[model samples]
Target chain A: MAVAAVRRLAATAPVPVFVARGGGTGLLPVELAFDARLRLVVSPRHATVLVAAGRFPGPLGVAVDRVHDQLPAPRGTLWWTADVDGDRPAALRDASVVTDADPVGSVVALHRDLCLGRIRSDAAVLADDPPNRFEGRGDHGQGGEGMMGGVPWGRPMAMTGDDRDGLALDRLPVVLGPFLPGFPNGLRVHAVLQGDVVQEAKLEVLDLGSGPRLDRLDPAAGGAQHDLRWLAEALRLAGLGALAVRAARLARAAPAPASRAALARLVRRSGLPAAWSGVGVIDGEDARARLVRRLDPSAPEGRSPGPSLERVAEVLVGQDWSDAVVTICSFDLPTDRAEAVIEAQA
Target chain B: MTAQAEVWAAPLLTAGVLAAGAYVVAVLDAAVAAAVSGAGIGRSVLAGPLRRAALLVVQQPSATERPDAASWALAPALYAGLAAAGLAVIPWSASFSVADVEAGIVLWGTVESLAIVAIFLHGWSANTHQSLLAAYRFLAAGLSYLLLSMFVLIAAAIPAESLQLSRIVESQHGLWNVVRQPLGLPLFAVVALGSSTWGPLNLADGDDLSGGTTADVSGRPRLVWSGARAAMLTSFSAMAATVFLGGWQGPVLPGPAWVVLKTLVVLAALVASGHLFARVRTERFVTVCWLVLLPLAFLDLVIAGVEAL
Candidate 1:
């Protein structure tokens, strides 16, 4: 009886959903953004429902399956694709498919069912095996040589390298996400990091299949709406979720000038400009400048398009991890056409 | 109350306050978030925490490719345990405290230091890049704030002439430390924010690193980690009240009531700061801590010492 009560109570909580946006997927679906019943989680581990919402071609399709397995038990996957009946990825064939213009109701219902054990949860697609062989010949599992030389668990251990401070420290090579939260969707950066600082970096954008985009459903949205949506994401990245939601709400509707002014005032009061000042400077303009520019609806439209994909690495080389993320997000990366134009080799 | 009853009630009180304070933090945070976002405020704010907890309880735990499972599990437990231990040293009323050790301030200091270890372990044990990066980032900045906390705490202890929290409260009977040393409470607020890793000082479990230390965590462990954060916020606020606002000293009502009321105010302030301020850049925060906050903390201590002399 206590378990039943818990299940019922859990069902009422907002469904933590991880949205896996394929290449060219613009801002979140307005329905998902507006619905309070759904929460977009940063990590797949924190989610119960994995919503694969775009065209996932090639390796990107495999990434969706990988993310699916990351979610803990009592989990489900929903494919929110345009061509529901036409063609679906083989991995997501058994998963629930939704082609509705507004799928918030479907997502909510699915979560309730998962919470109450109305359906069996999705199982892991990959086998529970290490991808690399543990080849350590040393007595202390240090591969063959010293402490930092080995592929212990299918991955090379961090090796010492020259750092910015003229000291030698262990440098760990990390490939940060096609699906990482707070990162641009489907863009991965191969970075060699010494401690929290990026030592060397390269950027790559995956060509997740291109199709009828989910977020561009309203093409009639003017430049104001585009700026507002970008402002919402920037706020979200700045750790201002409340302000982000308010910005998103404005983006979804025709806003009065008074509301926009009020939002600008709130933004100023929130100390965003002060906090972000001097962080991620590019061409004399910092993240703060980019954010301030977005707030002015009357500002001219021809903003400087940020660094191209190749230069992103140079921009990220010395930045702290968090600054690096904010720097990337601060750019106006025409996500819709980035893959086609900037296909640089990582 | 008899000595026997005092001994018995101490643990229960500490546990009860910790649990209740954590729940209150969640509710108050939700309310603040709603007000800021212009989201509708209603019964959902009150019920949101419990409902979320239930969801976590029912969900299964998740692990990375090769996580340090033991430390991952122990991290949250250790963090929450540290919170409870910190609360034990706080004097809720004149005649009541869990274990009012003679060196209670020293004990609280230990709690703040160990919190860094727990947070680092939580991030490192995950064996993921983002989590590990967060751990490294925290290690770099943790020491600066830790020193600031110690200096402010020592300043608060000066007027009392004893490290015992009860004596500190008693010392405040004549003049609260907040009034005597105006800089103490504001400086200590930094410690409370940093130690709990809340708001702008929350470099450890920030959204930038995809929840940072909590990125790969899920289910009950995630719930415990989050609860530990809230508990730390509460304990730090209670300590703030005890050291500065004169814990349990207000009149017209009972002693414990005053402590609770002051703690709630501090908690609300901390929560609001979390929402209002954008997270400081990690390097910038460290630079500010060392160059600015440290000197201010020293000045506070200097003022307290001169007053004592």
Candidate 2:
């Protein structure tokens, strides 16, 4: 009886959906914003329904499995692609699969079924393994050495490094997202951080299929929507959810003068421009300038294109995590085209 | 009722009230936030928090590899406990209060300080890069707000010549501190929001860190941590009512009713301000809080002190 009661309550809550963007799904953001039932979360740790949208290459298949295992028990996965379930677990083979053209609707339906107890959640795929095995190598499993040189728990302690402000601090190396919330889809960076400032950043590009040809589809309207999407994402990153939501709505309703004006007013009132003014620049335009240009319909033909991956790493090296995100989101990158360029160059 | 029984009963009663009030204010905050953001409101908004509570109750608690489980598990409960303890010094009415200590202002300040410690522990115990970064950010940014709040609290206490919250309320019989020290209320609101890590001041849980300290926390732990945050907001708004807006003192309504009403208004303001402004970066926020807000707070104190003299 208690279990049944809990399930009933859980079903009513918004579906915490972690969207795994594969290739370039242009409609995913618009679909996510259109539905109030779905809450697009950043981490798998906080999500229950994993929506794997678009086509994933062989390597990204492994990345999907890792993220799937990271979800807490009583979780589900919805594959929004053709035969993508080839790599998914057998338990999730049938009921959890959604090959529907409308991925968003399928996700909502799956969430509803899970909540109603119509389907049981998928079990953990990976074993409950500790991060590192303790072999009793030394006292307290320090690999026989004391604090100075031992690998504690199979990972080396962060060594001290000079920060941007000239202080020596422990530099923590972390990967900042292919799936991180508030970041460009499929963009990952291996960064060494000392006290929130990135000491070094190396771009890691996973070859997902071809990116969206946004310019080929109604370039003027598409460009406007793209700018709105950027603005919305930046606002969301800045912790302005309502404005982000409104901006996203305007993006969906692009080319409307009233909506454009409303979005512009929202941006100004949010103080986002002033807050982001001091961050590093892209193509001589800071985040504020990029945001302002995005809001203005007559500003330019093409949105200020994002810097190349190498240039991004260079610009991101000395910036704090917040500034890095703002800087990255400021520029519009044709990632699919860029990948093709790199292939040709090589 | 006997004095001993009353003493025990008062705290229990206040605790019950605060717990219930916390949930109500949380729901109201969600509704207002959703409405402003152009999301669904009305009954759906009310149902959102309840459903979240239910989901969290049934979900499993997760931990990162080799986390300090003891401290990590203890942090949320400790945060909520401190918020509850802070409520004891607030007078619901002249006769109805949990514990009206002589140094009530000091006690409340101590609670705020300890709440920060609890938050830092929550972040540190997670043993993840994001959580640790959030912990350090709070430590750096929280200091400026903490100092600013202390100065403003002292300013409110000056005219009353008392640290007792009830006395402070009594001191505002002629003119509330909102008028006496014009900058006191706004400055206090900013500090209250900053200390609680709500809205624009929510750097510890900002999108940059992907929910920051609470990134890895889920299920019941997330519920409790979030609840404690709402409770702390309630406690601060209640204190602000007593210190500046004249708590429980009103024309038509009874004392406790007035206190409740004023607290709700202050809470609404805090919630609205959180959604109104974009979150400033931590480094920039710290600079603004010290260079700009700190001096204004001191000026408010100086004026209050002179008035008392």
Candidate 3:
């Protein structure tokens, strides 16, 4: 009886969704923001449903597979625009694949079915093997040479290195996100971190297909809506969920001057502008200034667009991970152009 | 029942009450947080904890590569146990404490200190860079709050002249600590939020680290860890009520009812504060705690001491 009750409750809970964006699928975020039943989570671990929206390049297939494996069991995946192909996991073969249709309704339906136990969740696709095999050469067979330094289980132990703050600490290399929350879709960074500080960064840009360019949109309608989307994402990253939601709502409402002013007032009252004032300055305007300028209709078109991923990596080197996220979100880089530059650089 | 039987059963009953209270507090916290964030309070809001509980129950437990599996599994239960132990000394009414020792205040303090260690274990055992970073961040952030908590708790105890929580409540019969020591309640509230790692003080599971210590945790273990966090917040709010607002003391209501009322109020305030402020950077938060909150707490303690004399 208790088990049945628990199952019912689980079915009713807000669906935790993790979205992976493909090229030109900016409309999905707007749709998700308007949906009250869905809760957009930052990490795959927290998600019950992994929604892969838009085109998935061939290169990102393995990365997508890794993300798919990361979700806990009794989980489902919704392929909004693209389907897994060639060496795909068996579980994903049976996954919900939505192509060339309105994905919002289908995604919601998938979540409902998943929670209701109407659909059996995908099983683990990857083998349940440890990341590294332990073959240490020691008396106890504990991997490594000396007490402080050695490779353990085919992975080298992080050795002490000089940090940005001048403190010597063990530096660990981590790959953060092609699908990480609070980052632009397909932007992955290889970072060497000392504690929480980024000591060094390398950029990897996945080439998802190009979508509608923001610059081509009508300045009165699409431009205001586009700017609001950036503001919403920035607010969400800063742990300001309510404000983010409000911004999204403002974007949906007529895209009028009155609504825009209200959105600006909401941003100011949120105290986020003041808090983000000096953090992550781009083109001489900090994150707060950029956000404010985006909200204003009369603000001049200033500075050349499309800061390279390498430039972003340079800016991120010494900043705390939290500040770095804000910095990255502050710049509205055209995804297609950025991808082109990244490919050229490579 | 015999005296010995009563002694044995008293703790068992108190444990049940604390567990129930913790569940209630968690639900109420969700409601209040949603309401304050402009998400209208509804029947659906109440379903959140239940739904999360159900989801966690059915999901499989996951581990990172080369994780300390034993320690990883142990941390959540250990955290919850410490929270339950802290609740043991908090008297529901004058005669309703599970373990009303002579040094009950000190006992609560020790449990809180152990919570820091337990959280560190949870983060470190994950074997992920983000998790380890979160663990270290908690240690750095935990220090300032720990000192602030001790000073505030000691300040509250100074007027009572007894470490016993019941005695402390009795001392507030004439005037509550919030009235007598102006800075005491706010200081204790801040410390409680920090100690429980909730709201602005939730650096251990903050967004920057993508859920931080809990980044890799899922299934039943995740439920336990999150529930333990909620339980810790409930316990802290109860302690705050007991220490400063005159626990179980009210004009018209029964003693237990008053204790329950005050606890809910404090819990509501804590949850509301969580939605009000964005997370502060760890270094800046530490600086503010030490430079501003510490000196203010010290001054409050001195004032309490003077009043006691």
Predicted structure with the largest TM-score when compared to the true one: 1
TM-score of each: 0.94, 0.92, 0.88
Choose the strongest candidate by DockQ.
1
Against the native complex, each candidate's DockQ, computed on alpha carbons, is 0.75, 0.64, 0.45
Q: Write the per-residue lDDT of candidate 3 for residues B15-56, one digit (tens) a residue.
A: 676567667866776675455434577786666777777888
Cα miss at B245, model 3 (Å)? 1.2
Give the winner by lDDT: 1
lDDT of model 2 at position B114: 87
Residue-by-residue lDDT tens digits, candidate 3, A1-346: 7777776677766777877765545533643664567777767888889876666656565577778888886688877653334233343456677765345677677766776789888777767654665555644354544444355544456668887667889876677777765677677888877767888998877776543321223344555566666677766666666656666666565556776676566556656666676776656767777767776766644223657888878888887776777777777655533233433556
Segments of candidate 2 deviating more than 4 angstroms: A82-95, A99-101, A127-156, A164-168, A211-220, A300-302, A336-346, B1-8
lDDT per residue for candidate 1 within A1-346, as digits (tens), equals: 9999999999999898888876545555422555577777778888888888767777777778778888998898888877654345555878888776577778888889999999888888877776766554765665635677577665667889889889999888777878765556678888888887899888887775555555553433455676777777777667787787888889878789789888988888888888777867777888789888878766756245567877767888888888888878777566543322333311
Off by over 4 Å in 3: A1-5, A82-93, A99-102, A127-156, A164-168, A211-219, A255-271, A282-284, A292-306, A336-346, B1-12, B36-39
**1 or 3, which is superior by DockQ?**
1
Error of 2 at A242 (Å): 1.7
Predict model 1's lDDT versus the native: 0.82
lDDT of 2 by residue, B37-87 (tens): 576686777788777787777677876878999999999989888888888
After TM-score superposition, the amount by which residue B139's alpha carbon in candidate 2 deviates from its true location, in angstroms, is 1.3
Ranking by TM-score: 1, 2, 3
lDDT of 3 at A171: 76
